[model samples]
Target: MGTRGLVAAMALMLCFGVDRVVSDASDHRYKAGDPVPLYANKVGPFHNPSETYRYYDLPFCSPEHVKEKSEALGEVLNGDRLVDAPYKLDFRVDIDSKLVCKKKLTKEDVSQFRTAVTKDYYFQMYYDDLPIWGFIGKVDREGKTDPSEFKYFLFKHINFDVLYNNDRVIEINAYTDPNALVDITEDQDIEVEFFYSVKWKETTTPFEKRMEKYSQTSSLPHHLEIHWFSIINSCVTVLLLTGFLATILMRVLKNDFVKYTHDEESAEDQEETGWKYIHGDVFRFPTNKSLFAACIGSGTQLFALTVFIFILALVGVFYPYNRGALFTALVVIYALTSGIAGYVATNFYCQLEGTNWVRNLLLTGCLFCGPLFLNFCFLNTVAIVYSSTAALPFGTILVILLIWTLVTSPLLVLGGIAGKNSNVEFQAPCRTTKYPREIPPLPWYRGTIPQMAMAGFLPFSAIYIELYYIFASVWGHKIYTIYSILFIVFIILLIVTAFITIALTYFQLAAEDHQWWWRALLCGGSTGLFIYGYCWYYYYARSDMSGFMQTSFFFGYMACICYGFFLMLGTVGFRAALFFVRHIYRSIKCE
Candidate 1:
């Protein structure tokens, strides 16, 4: 390219960058109607930060005007009307502010209202048709109404005058209320409009009105945009941790834990017990099958719930971008999971070669019902505190509890019984571990805590940034978009759990960590602890999420319980797979 052309292109790029910033501040173009930010953080315990501005019509209407308008409407309709007593102008506002950015309001935006008594254009009022309302800014150049004390009755009629300062823009809303409409009805109708105007300043240097355009992606609520770049940024530290710990586990399992020497007397005793005694005792294998059952049960429940929600989104049951819908869905889904958990766990436990039926039933009940009860308590407390209609009442909670205990819980037990009584066969391919060789402890590698904790970190790291963004939208009052990204991240989490499980198990086995099953389970699930920590940091330190720790009790408890459940599942799954592998190896040797 010519030097002149290259220079022109660079100049254009610079000019475009500057213009893009300016345009963002000045742009009033809404994809539909006025471009208004529609979502807000959930109103917490102490205060509902959300505020609204109302602009009513001017002029005091006497009793005569009300009578005349009533007569006019009745005359227009004649006697064939739908039960109308008088021409009374009614104004109503129902605001719901705790919506995510991707959400939409159920109600349509309010149209301009014209009153019969006051014919002036400025007497119109603007209203939000949707339940959710967010106040952007109020403008009043008239000295009567101060910006400090926004006059709600006199503030809804005018278009916003947007003033740009530095990189930010300010939108000024204006309106007025008149006393003439007092005799018209109990209330009056006022019209409101949302409009934006741009203001640019000029200094000494001759500046041209730079015209440039650029494209930026917008967001919706509870949606994440996970890209390769995002993976690189978020997962690097997690992957590093996994790889390093995996090596340590391998070393501990092989070099330190499994090396055992059998004396001549012990060898003879083993020979007397037959071939099974050659390597070790038969009962030495830890009861690790439960771990597998836990993971499969939890994983299945999570899979089903996520699919149900996104499918609902696709079908517009809750509407993809509405915050209230999202909250409602979350609560409903959590309640539904009790049944799923009970059924899966009961069925799996029955399949295991265990004899204690009572133990199995109790375990299943605790696994499924415990979390539900905790969630219920938290939700009820919040509902009472906020006086939110969204909260299920105590009676409803009791009913749900009854249904779970009577219907879902019993069904699981029945399923378990059926499964146990079935003639299904699961023969191990081989039983490699002959003796229940006592594995020495390794602080960093052995036991449930370290392994489970380590496993919990991988999936959380994969989407940490995305999670941060989601929290911001919910609590920090930022906009969220890109549902597709969240779907992909959910998939990534599943894959991560599976892959880390397989990899850690193999590594442990190679180290001859005969206790590979439990270790592997821990490796998959421990990452949840990392997520919980992130949540704490985000809620307490990083963001301005206040009062929510107590008021958003239901969701908070649900999140914790969910994290624990997944962690347990991942840990148990690894152990189950390791147990089956060991069983198969031993069986093959006997054959």
Candidate 2:
């Protein structure tokens, strides 16, 4: 077959496959009597339960609150975290059908059932991540009820304040119907309706007022005060770094440019030193160019994804009320952005005179994903062993892999092919010499380690305060509502990364180091190191998290997060350094 025919056949197959999946997904219809899975969003410590209360075995949901899918009846409800709530409650599905009451019950049986109903019958209601607990009240038993009769108890007697202040209260009321009574003579299908209601009231207590305030500001560490402080701190840091950069670029570099390009100066007067001395070799193709290109490509993709996600967040598209929306957005955006990774990686690799386009494309796809996938697997394994909700079920893991394989991988290949076909050579100001230049030994302070430490620190410092709130939202059970502040901090981080990286690259160049490519990338990326450090400090010194499972999950994901940061910031740094290097080299009189 011709290439066009093959392409047409492939397209037809792809469309058919997608249509089949969509049809299969839409085939499942809601039916009565099917077991509906119940899910609660976030769980936080209400008031600390006394030892006696704890020993009473009050049903509480897993801390992670991971949702699972089942081929059962009922709609899954998601809500925001209730930070000020005092008690944790597990969401119960009617499928369990555990009898709290029995037929021909004695006084002792009645007493035990009452105790169990009070302690164990908790319902979780959520408005986004916030969850409110309600207990079942007044269980009515209909004796000798016919199987055909509707014998379900009403959930109308729930006792909890639905509203605080003047805001309307949203409550979830779920009850087992028709089959809840154990005295039914014949086999019957049971159905549960998970109902929701909004209540408005004028009266509320001071404690409710406090709870309202707590809910609004719960996600932040220092609340409004910390928000302002973070902004001010980031502004001051940016200003300082901006001033430093201005001085170096306008004054120091301008002088270097004038000295190097001055035609009146004789060969004797022209000292073959500094950045001007290595103009030819400055843009020389670095070792492991394919890897470097892949890193930068992936970084660019991340950069774009982060910016787009933040923009959406800033516009309130990803508000805290939309449970799991952020994660969904990230996954979708990342998958769609796979093409960017492929294009950048392949294009840059080609520019670096790389021959193995296939290898470059594969590395681009796997560079960040490989470590992330492995870490996720490990974390999920730990979560499964512990029976933690944090674990992605096998089905979910399969779905993720399918998405990567079918959607992301194909786009990556397409992008790589396009990039390779349109490959452009690197534009160097001066051609590289036959031999490489020797690098002089530097002091410990000026070494790569120290440079990265310094470069990474500035960017990390700009976001450290904000990072606390982010960590709290992710690891701790705090809701993150302030995306605008996060967006500002994100911009600040980028600015700091770019400025610091350029400055550091200049210093490295002045020290006769021609290997600024990877250095520039790492110098900016070192922020991840500091972020990981902060994670450690937060876990050990600040957070109340204990046990091996939580620790492993935290650090494992943290590693991936840090690695992503390294790639993202490193790319920003590399770009800034490239522009700076190119501009300086262009300004000089080269042989």
Please, what are the lDDT tens digits per residue for candidate 1 over residues 1-591?
A: 001111111111101000011112134223312333211112111121111111111121112332111111111111110111111111111122211112111112111211221211221111111112223222323565554442222222122222222322222222222321112211334333322222233223211211100001233222223444575565566567657866775574344222222323244333322222323333233474554454455555555555776666455343222223443344345445545554565556556665565565566555534554565466545544544323443554465456555655565566556656654644444443544555444556645575566556677777787777655544433444445666776666666676567655554544445555456656666665666667677766665434452325423543645454454446445545556455434432332
Q: How many angstroms is residue 463 displaced in model 2 relative to the true structure, after the best TM-score fit? A: 1.1
Global Cα lDDT for candidate 1: 0.40
Q: Candidate 1: minimum summed lDDT over ten consecutive residues — where?
A: 12-21
Q: Write the per-residue lDDT of candidate 2 for residues 1-591, one digit (tens) a residue.
A: 001111111111111111111111142222323221233333222210100111122232123343333311001111121222222222221223232221243444334434434233343444222334544333443564553443323232222223232322223333334332232222333232222322323345542233344347654556677677767877797678778777867798878877765632655455588877787689888899889989988998888777777677677564433444444455657778889889988998999989998999999999988887776667556655754334454665566678789888998999899889985889888889988888889888988898998898778878888888776666554667778778878887888889889998998899888989989989989998999899889888877765576567567667777788889889999998899888888777777
Model 1: runs farther than 4 Å from truth?
1-131, 135-228, 231-299, 314-343, 382-391, 402-407, 432-435, 441-448, 476-481, 548-561, 564-591
lDDT per model vs. reference: 0.40, 0.60
Q: Which candidate is the best by lDDT?
A: 2
TM-score of each: 0.54, 0.71
Model 1 lDDT, residue 323, Cα? 20
RMSD of each: 16.6, 12.9
